[model samples]
Target: MQATPVNPHSSPLVRVALLAYTFLIVYASWYPFSDWHTIGLSPLAYFSEALPRYWTFFDVSINVLGYIPFGILLMLACYPWLPRRWAALLCMLAGSLVSGTMEAVQTYLPSRVPSILDFITNCSGLFIGILMGCVLTPWLLQKDLLRQIRVRWFVPSMSNGLIIVALWPLAQIYPQGYMFGLGQLVPVLSNWLNIYLGIPIDLGSFIRQGAQLSIEQYWLSETIITCCGLIGAVLLFLCLLQPKAPKARLVTLLIFICLGVKSLALALLFKPEHAYSWFSPGAQAGLLVGCLMLYGLAFTPARVQRHLAIFMLTISLLVINFVPGNPYFTDTLSTWVQGKFLNFNGAAQFLAILWPWLAIWFLLHYQPAKSTNPA
Candidate 1:
C-alpha cells in the first residue's frame, strides 16, 4: 500500500528515540560484554546445526517481539529522509545486521548458545515490525496526533517527559536501596574504576562510611531518599507537562507505573509469594509524603516545576550516593545469579543507576518553545 505523503521534514525526536532503543537492543543482546577467546569453529557454524528442539514459547515470543521496535523505529527514523521502499529495506537490513552481530558475538560467550532459529525469529519479527510501522506511520504522522499529544500532555518544545517515561519502567529492573531511587551510579562507577585502575576507591561509600548509622538512622535515611526520589521524578515529569494538562492525574499515573514496574520486577526476580516484600514502612511513608508533595505542586508553573525538580533531584542523588547501601537490601541480591542473564542484568543496572543523572542533564538543557501553535 502507498503511504500518505505529508511534509518531508524529519523529526529529531524520532531519530533520537531510534538510537536510544538501538543501544538498548545491542546491550540486551551482548550483555556482560566479556570473554574474548574463541575456538576455530566459525561463528556461522550455528547455521548448520540440526533443527532446534522444542523451545519454550516464552523465549520464542520474547525474541520475536523484541525486534519489532527495531524495525518500527528504524523505518520511522528513515521515513522523512528516504524513499519509502528504501527506508523499509534499510530498516530490515539494519535489524538483520544487528541480529547477525549478536549471534556472532555469542559464539565467544561460554554462557550463550547461538541458534539460527533465534536469528530467523528475529528477522521475522523485524519484518512484521516494518509492516506495522508502514501501516501506522501514515496515521501517526499525517494526523498530527503526536503534536496534539505534546501540546496537551507535554511541554511544547521539550521531550524530557518522553525519555523519562520510557526509562521509568526499565529502571525498575534493578534493585535499589530506596523506592524511585534511580540514579545511584557513584558506587558502581567507583568499583569499576577501582578494578581497572587498581585503586581502592568509591566516592559514595567513602563519604557514607564517615558516620555509622543506628537502626533509626537507617530507617530515616531510607524514608528521606524514597520521598526525595519520588518527588523529584514526578516534578521532573510535571516540568514537562503543559500548565493546562492534568498534572495531578498524570503524576498519579506516573507513580502507579513506577510502582507497577517495581512490583513486576520483584515478582520476576523472586516469586509471586514475595512480590510485596519491597513495600516496607519507610517506603510507605515516602510514598505518602511524595504523593502529597505532588498534589501540592501540581498547580505550579512549568518553569517553577523544573527548578523544583532540579533541587529535588540534587538532594536525592546526594543522599542516595553518599549514604551506605542498605544492609537489608543485600538479601535480595543474594538470589541474583549472574550467568547468562549477566548481560541483561548489567545493562539494566547501568540504566537504573545512571537514569536520574541523565534526566537532570536533559532538564538542564530543556527549553520551551517561544511561540504558541496557531489554532
Candidate 2:
C-alpha cells in the first residue's frame, strides 16, 4: 500500500501577505481617498460601458502587474486547506471579485475612472499568477527541500518576522532624507494637518524651534539615522535566525540588497543620472560603522539582540522625525516623476512609513519557541 503524504499546514505569513497586498490594492485604487461626492452614476455602469477611449500599454501593464502578486499569495494561502484545482478556482474568483469591487468604487471618485478593460486585464493577470503559483507551491510548501531549509535556518515562530525581513528592502524603495530611514511620521502628519485641517504647523520645524541646523549637523543626523536603522534592521534579522545560521553572510547579503533596491528605486523615480546619489559621504561612514557594530554583536544572545534592535529603532525614529529637513533632499524631490507610478509610489511610501514601526512591534512581541519541523 502506498503511504499518504502528510497534510500541508497553513502559514500565518502567507495569510498576512495576502491581506497586506489586498490592503495595498485597495489603497492604491482609491488613493488620495478624499472628495466623496456622489457622481449620480451606477457603480456597476462600468460592467456594460464601452472601453476607455484613451488607453496605453502602461496602464494595462500596471493593472495586470499589480494584481499578479495578489493572485499568487491568495492561492498559496489556500493551498493547505483545499485541493489544488479548488484553490486555483478560488484565487481566480477572489482576484476578479476584488478587481470588480475596486473598479466599481472608482466610479464614485472624480479623479479615478472605472474601466472594463482594467478589470479584464486584472483577471488575465490573476490567471497567469495562479498558474505560476500552482507550479511552485508543491516544491515550496510540500514538506520539501525548501521547507527543510526554512526549518533549519530560522528560529521557530517567525512567520511575521520573516515577512518583516522580506519587506525591509522594499521599504527602502521610497525615497528618504537619510539612507535607510524608514519611519519619519512627523512631516507626513504635519502635511496632512496643514492640507486637510487648515492648520499651519510644521511639526519638525516646531520641534527644532527655528534653530537652523548646520550642514555639519545635518550630516551628523543622517549618519546617526543610517547607522541606527541599518543596525536595528540587521539585528532583527539575526534575532529571528537560528544560532547556526550564517549571520555574517546573511547580513552582508541583506545590506547589499537593500542598497541595490534603494539605488534602483532612485533611478526609476528620478533621473538615471541621480541613480547613485544616495551614496553620500555620511551614508558611507554610517555603513562602515554599522557593519563593524554588526560584526561585534554577531554572537550576542537573541534576547539581547532583540532589545538592542528596539533601542536602535527607537533612536532612529526620534532623530529622523525631529531633525529638520535637508534642503538638498527637498531639491531632489522636485525631480521625482510621479506621473505613471502613482499607485506604486503610494504603496512604496506606505511600506516605507510603516516598516520600522512594524519591525519594532515584531521584535517586542515575538516570543521564539523551540525549533521543530512544521506540520
How do all models score by TM-score? 0.86, 0.91
Q: Which residue segments of model 1 deviate by more than 4 Å?
A: 2-10, 51-55, 79-90, 108-113, 197-205, 337-340, 368-375
Worst 10 residues of 2 by lDDT: 1-10
Instruction: Write candidate 2's Cα lDDT for 1-375 as tens digits.
Output: 122243478666778788877887898888867787688899998899888888889779978887788888987888777778878888888889999999899888887888899999999888888988887677677856555666788887787787899899989988898898789899889989999899999988888887888888888888999999999999999988887777788888988899898888888789887789988888888888988999888888888888999999999999999888878889999988788677677778888999999999888898755546444
As a TM-score, model 1 comes out at 0.86
CA deviation > 4 Å runs, candidate 2 = 1-7, 370-375
lDDT of 1 by residue, 169-226 (tens): 7898787877777788787788888888988886775776677778777777778878
TM-score of 2: 0.91
Each candidate: what lDDT? 0.76, 0.84
